[model samples]
Structures are given as C-alpha cells and as structure tokens.
Target: MPDRRDLDIGELMTAFDAVVRANASLMTQLSSRAGVHDTALRALVLVSDTGYSTPTEVAGFLGLTSG
Candidate 1:
C-alpha cells in the first residue's frame, strides 16, 4: 500500500483527469460501434431493479425507445 500522507493533491487531480479521459475514449468506441449493446446493458440494469419491464421501458431509460 502507498502512504496516504505522501499523496499530493495535484498528483491526484492529474490521475483523476487521466481516468476520465480514458473512459471518454472507451465510451466513444462503444457509442460508434456497439451503441445498442450499451442500451441493452442499461436495460438489463433497469430490469434487474424492477424485476420485469417492457422493451419500451428499457429503451426509454436508455433514450433509445419510446412507448
């Protein structure tokens, strides 16, 4: 483990920025190619929470479908 006291705020901020940038790049790829997969994943989460719902509900939550 690293020493928490040794962590500089500037270094932590830089690391956070790098992580956000990496995630943006990854989301761009998913949006460009497997966008529907992203919608499906969100729908899965909603179904898991509410037990069951129509495809329209899932799509609506993901901003892809309407009832």
Candidate 2:
C-alpha cells in the first residue's frame, strides 16, 4: 500500500478535482451518445455514488415519490 503520510493534502485535492472533472466530461459525452437528459445522467451518477441498488433508496436520495 502507498504511504498516506507522504501525501500532500493540497496536491491530493487537486488530483481528485482533476479526476472528477474528467469523469464529469466523460459522463456528459456518454449522456449525449445515449440520448439521455442531463438530469438522468446526474441521477445515475448519484445512484452509483450512493451505492444504492434499490429504486426506493435511489428515490429517497433524489427526493422522489417511490410510486
């Protein structure tokens, strides 16, 4: 495992931000190719981030009525 003690917080944050921007860009591209709206793409990302496998959990996270 890498040494966490040797990592600079500022540098780590910068790297993380870069990766997030790249991921967002990729998601945008994929959304366009899939013909999905931005909201649906964002919801998919949110579901993946939250590790919610059930629609009920996703709906709760999205503040939607699970009907």
RMSD of 1: 7.3
Q: Please give the range of 10 consecutive residues that has the lowest summed lDDT in model 1.
A: 34-43
Per-residue lDDT of candidate 1, residues 1-67 (tens digit)? 6677556766889899999899767666775686566555556668999999987777777788444
Clashes of each: 0, 0
| Model 2 TM | 0.56
Tens digit of lDDT per residue, candidate 2, span 1-67?
5576557776788899999999879888999998997668878988788776587666666578745
How high is each candidate's TM-score? 0.43, 0.56
Q: What is the lDDT of candidate 1?
A: 0.73
Give candidate 2 regions above 4 Å deviation: 1-7, 42-52, 60-67
lDDT of each: 0.73, 0.78
Error of 1 at 23 (Å): 0.4
| lDDT for 52 (candidate 2) | 64
Error of 1 at 31 (Å): 1.6
